[model samples]
Target chain A: MDAFQAIADPSRREILRLLSRDTMTINALADNFDMSRPAVSKHIKALDSAGLISIQNIGKERYCILNQEGFDELQEWIDYFDTFWKSKLKKLEMLLNEKAGK
Target chain B: MNRDIVHRWQFRQSPEIVWEHLTKPELLSQWLMANDIKPEVGHKFRFTTNPLLKFGFDGIVYCEVLEVDPPKRLSYSWKGGPGNGKIALDSLVTWTLTLKDGGTELLLEHTGFSGMKNYFGYLMMKNGWGSKIRKRLGALLAGPGK
Candidate 1:
């Protein structure tokens, strides 16, 4: 599943929000939801497949935390034009500087 | 994600100089893509860049001026995708220029990234902007990425 599909579900997005604050065990994450444990597991698998969250095993528990790989591109895309204008304006500054010198 | 992009820059030039760079088609093509932009409300323009046939992008951004306040603000509609006449992403790009302490400050806001299918194009747009800003403008300034 892609990052877009991973975020399509509200439950998955909630999981991401919770994990962003702090790492949560699979059971802890599942407890926060109103669905079955298997259903929650299904969502986690989808998130895992999308590389949005990472599951780590410590002793008997699997902890899920937010992954940087998730939505990095999305965030970049959202901020793309902002950067574009900055660069464009910077070039404008150079042209203005040349005009001032002459 | 909010999907809204806002950025601001300060240049040591008057609003008129910066405004010319924004509204003049020739100056815009030097910095942005090739376009026949005019400084008037309701003017239609198109920006052409390197074609991305594989990603369904014809590298053409069709635009129409929505607002024009000379030496102050300019807004336009941006739509780009495959040349099939189908709009891949429909968004608005606004530019605001303000005179400051013998200089000008420019603010840009691009919004309206709706739905999931457009996300891919959005990602490509991000890379395209990043590269252009970092590469082309950086080359002109000689030290932007630093």
Candidate 2:
């Protein structure tokens, strides 16, 4: 699942909301949600796959922390063109300026 | 994320000169990439560039002129990708030249960045996600991640 699909769910977005503030274990995270532990786990797993969170094993407990990887793909697409269009236009401007100068 | 890219520039040159630079393949290669672009509508062409492996694009943009109005407006279908000629980005590129008081006004709009399958769900994620999510994560990310 991509970031958008992962975030489409309110529960998963809540999970992201919680993780962004503090790193928490599955049990602690499940306690905040009214859903079944396994269901929350499924959501957590989806967030992990979407690169929204990173899971780490601290002893027997697994901790989930918010990550930026999820936003990279979406942000990068726009940023690429942002730079590309600006630079390409700059080049075009220079071409016109040079021709007029001559 | 970005729905479209729009750029407008003022040039002392005339619209006719700007139109030539836009439609002529040889002049186009100077500003854009090397391509066999013709002003005629329905003409097919492609721009050759280095492969952008990170973005899943081979860097060559295949195009077809959808509309043409000399010295006024032009549009084309832009499609490209790699692997058996798969199309990753299928978009519309448009250019408009309007005569201004002193010279020509060039406008470019490159749209349709949301159609990619993996990014399709994001159409709602833009407005639906809203400022709530950003407000929640902004402080956290700004604190340590910056």
Candidate number achieving the greatest TM-score relative to the actual structure: 2
Clash number by candidate, in order: 0, 0
- Stretches > 4 Å off in candidate 1: A1-76, B52-55, B115-146
List, residue by residue over B1-146, the lDDT tens digit for candidate 1: 44677778888878998898888888888777889999778999999988755334578989999999999999999887667786645778999999999898888888765323354334335434334323322322221123
Q: What docking class should model 1 receive?
A: incorrect
Pull out the clashing pairs in model 2: none
Candidate 2 stretches greater than 4 Å from native: A1-53, A63-72, B117-146
List model 2's recovered fraction of native interface contacts, to 2 decimals.
0.30
Which structure among the candidates has the greatest DockQ? 2
A1-102: candidate 1 lDDT, tens digit per residue: 566558668788778767756789999999999999999999999999888889999999999977765545434544565676677767767777887899
